[model samples]
Target: MTDDREAIVPVWTLATGDVRVPALAGDRPMTAERLTELRGVLAALADEPIATLEVHPLSDKLDRGRGIPLDAGSPLAQHLSQLITQSAKSSSVAAKATATGENLYRMVVPAKTAAQLGQGIVRPMAAKGVANGIRGAFVNSKGTIVDAASFVPVGKAAAAGAAGGAGATAGVAVAGSAALTVAAPLVLMAVAVGVSAHADHQRQQAITRITELLEQLHDQKLDDERSELDGCRDAIDKATAILLDQGKLGVSLGLDSAVHAIGKALAAADRRLTKWENALDELPEGKAVEIDTLTKSFPGVDDDGGTFRTHLELAGLAIALKRRVIVLQAVDHAQSDPGNPFENFARALKADQQRLDELESSIAGVLERLSALELTRTNSFRPVLTTGEVDRLMRAASRIRKLGDGVMVNSRATDVAIDIARNKDGSVVVFPSQPA
Candidate 1:
């Protein structure tokens, strides 16, 4: 292992499923110093405003009092479906529907979950085994990959090399010129479309899986699943909103990556349909199903199903990825002030700021839509929270349930409950009945 201080590098480790910081690409074990440098990079990313938009596509439309029919297939209809989902998911709602058919603002989330949501910090790290790599979790509005590194455009290098360097003067240019000629522009464009669709589809998969995972998590022990579920939920909230606000008919469907991989593949098909839409005259065979999906307003396609909303989330992730890539690349242009570390830090800080700004804008929209739904919490847990140091025993009870309504999950009054009994002298106490 070479010392990481020697201009440390990152490599993807297939065996450990992580990004390994190394002295060089092929080097064995990474030096402690390189690991430290990589940690800084991970820390920088962790500090980003982690916002994910989750679209709640309606399986059916909410009928207006004066309505003849409310269409679920329409774009605006889908937006409303998501707003209802947010409020419903909050721990505030009972299993029963709104008996009054009334709608108002509600803060839906388990009390503890909501409390945990005080926008806690996130820290990114590499998993072990593979080369240097981060989890491909962050996605854009278009459902495309959003990593710090994407393949750089090859055109620039090709052009730069042809103009100058080595033996351009010796007509090394002629052979290169013929090679470029042989590669058809249309063929390359077609290939790009296929690659774009595939990337979009994979992103969809991640979104669906994660969403389905969240639903299942609610059935599990709270202690076992709260933290991970919270993270996934936040991602969905942010990703869904992005797609609802800004998505096109075909090329960009905002779908989540966790619960819907197949949705992405279909989206890939949609992309192919879009690419050939302009030039169907030249190539018009073997696309009957894809063409039908676009026609008749995508009838019988179950667009409002989990399979459908998943695509919307992926599209949103794709767009977000593009924005992130642009912002990250922009940082490279900043002239670093070596004497002032802040200069380099400033570039990174600015990128983070831009991301947060985007998140704030998205949140404002989501809150606006949700504000109309009445998901208010009628009751909640109250604990004596003091500014001064509190005993560890007290800390356990200090946790407040999120989205606390009238009901309590494992109340002190109920059997098989746990509590941190505390004494007046600020010591531990045990009670036969737990405190509510």
Candidate 2:
């Protein structure tokens, strides 16, 4: 048969001797490294993954009447609560501890198996509790004492005397004293329980406050994102309008007509040059020839002899003339090549078109994000955007506006005029000048 006893887990053991008072108020700030170390130690004892950890210093001292006072807001009380949480996470045991009215810490770790009931928990506690500065005993759920420790000698004697006098009254009657000393320890125990209850209430209140603050921050972030999305949409629309107007102006200026005329001229010149080259290729080859019977019939011809050697030379002058014509045609085509009227404008337009496309894509993405955020808001879920993403969107919008303004200025066209204005709310407004 399995034992139905609860297992004891060690929560925290205070350092032996005098308890050190924590320096809560000091110039030294808490560093991340120290916090990490503390978190590691607590997590090890808890034996469970820690979701969150927080620490707060006690602003006031505990009441000293009930031994070591374990008030709700005291640092010692908070530490006790931490210990209980740690132990509960590690073992099936449920426990609570608090500071006594005498300013001493006390905890109860339940006894488990037969061997653990006394040897595992009780004996070790009895031997180590006093050295650890703990003034109370480990008790089971049945109110059975597993082990006890006392720092004060007087308290120990009173407790022993109380046990001896259990049958008579409630505590040992002191000789020559009307009041029983054993009553003091019993009052201390009662106050510790009350303090533990109060501490629990305070912890709950703190948790609720923290939750509310986080919710407020989340809502604010959503509001900021919505505002940014509106701004981005406005920028995209303005930029698109500017580019369209510039494109129209370019067409009206006959810039497109000029480019078309030049293209036609170049094509015609190329065809004429090709025709001349073919004609030059078809010309007959030239050769040198000698006529021996020469000109015997020519009476006026100089004749050292009737068969005197006579040479005739023929060169391809027609082919050379055709080649010269082709060269002239090529030069004429080059000189008449009307360059693009709005070279800079064309380049800017291409770049702006690409940027415009990107802006549209970004707008779509942001809209999807906004829709998701809206759904989360409707469902009362937390929605957040990173600071970097927000900044990137803002920068993109700014660049689009600047690029649009540059295109208008560089176009130098009298048809389009950009105007900047400010509303009463100190927000900037951009618009095109109305034609009179």
Candidate 3:
């Protein structure tokens, strides 16, 4: 016996779908209201069972609200409706309602049946002006388009139809010359629009990447600046601690005072030296006659009486003795002179000037060391002072302290007196005595 068997096929299958309307063109996005209108139009034409109806908004997810299901007469429609209504009432819907690219409407039917519905029902509705602003396509389980259609704008359709009819007639009349001119601009405009869109998309992506990179660089630079500031603070703290520990906190101030004192001393010594120099210059010219008379004078008086020869000899002898006595007196005055004011002033000036030079040199050395530390801080984000650098700075502090001590000793010495005694063997002893 021969038996006839029928093959069974799955009712529900996966399909790729897209539905774009006129509102999605240009800068306009698919808003909620517009999506509802499109859904209503699709619902009126959907006579068969639809498995799912997914609506993707053209706008970003943040702007698009909760999803709304199509009010189609299907088994899943009531459950989807309830879910959407609940989601709309509550603000905390975790699931994203919309996506970016395309909206989908699927039917749980055989591929043949879906294709028939698209051509018969959907295309008829488009022809009747119900799907006027719609453009869509449906793919089968194999990811191939089962059916697709686009509702052309009335103006574009009319222009296309007119151009086609004219080109057909002109092809025979002008030997295609008139047709080429008319069609060339339209083709070129379409190509230009496509190229411009592509270029604009690429430019936006490049700008986004560049902006991200710039932001990263800026953040890194700020971090480096902060690190540099931290290093500077640390360096300053270390330097301060070093100074405090060495008991040289006021070294700079002491040095400054010493400089001022030395400057004053130098000025006073300069004045005294000038005065003594003037006195020395005047002494030679003003005392010349006195010196000459003293040279010719004698110590003894004349003893001869009345006779010319005897009186002359006695006068010569008296003059010779007086001259000798004058010479001896002058020698005694020079040998016992207390001090040469000119020499003392010159020596004091030289000593004070030397001290001034030493103080200035110390100041310069300190400044140079500080400058080097500053440059290191300036050039690097995080600078660590070397052992040599720390040692140098410590040495500077020591020198400054020594300078202060020397100044203090000199200042005290100026207010005191020293007595010097010579021994029999030419050795000398100095005893410092307080001023009365």
Q: Which rank order by TM-score, best down to worst? A: 1, 2, 3
Instruction: Return whichever of 1 and 3 wins on TM-score.
Output: 1
TM-score of 3: 0.15
- Residue-by-residue lDDT tens digits, candidate 2, 257-356: 4334323433433443344335333433342111111122211112221111000000011111111122222222222221311122223323323322
| Residue lDDT tens for model 3, 1-436 | 2221211111111111111122211212233244334333432333321121222122212111111111222112222232233323331210233111122322122223222211111111001222111223333223434322221100110111112211110001122111111121111111111212222222233233333433444445433422322223222223223321222223343333333332343344344334433433343342222221211221111111112112122222222222222222222222232232112222332332343333333333332322222111112244786786566445434432332221111121111111222222222221211121
Worst 10 residues of 3 by lDDT: 152-161
Tens digits of per-residue lDDT for model 1, 1-436: 2222222111111110011222221223344344334333432232211111111111112222111111343222332233233224431221122222222111111122111211111110111231211111322223333333221101101121111111111111122111111111111111112112222333344455436643643434322322322233333434433322222222233224322432343355346334433333333344322222222332212222232223333334433333222222222222122222212323443444343234323423332322222221122264553443233222322211111212222222111111111112222111111111
- Compared with the true structure, all predictions reach lDDT values of 0.25, 0.24, 0.24
Stretches off by above 4 angstroms in model 2 are 1-169, 172-195, 198-208, 214-436
Better of 1 and 3 by lDDT: 1
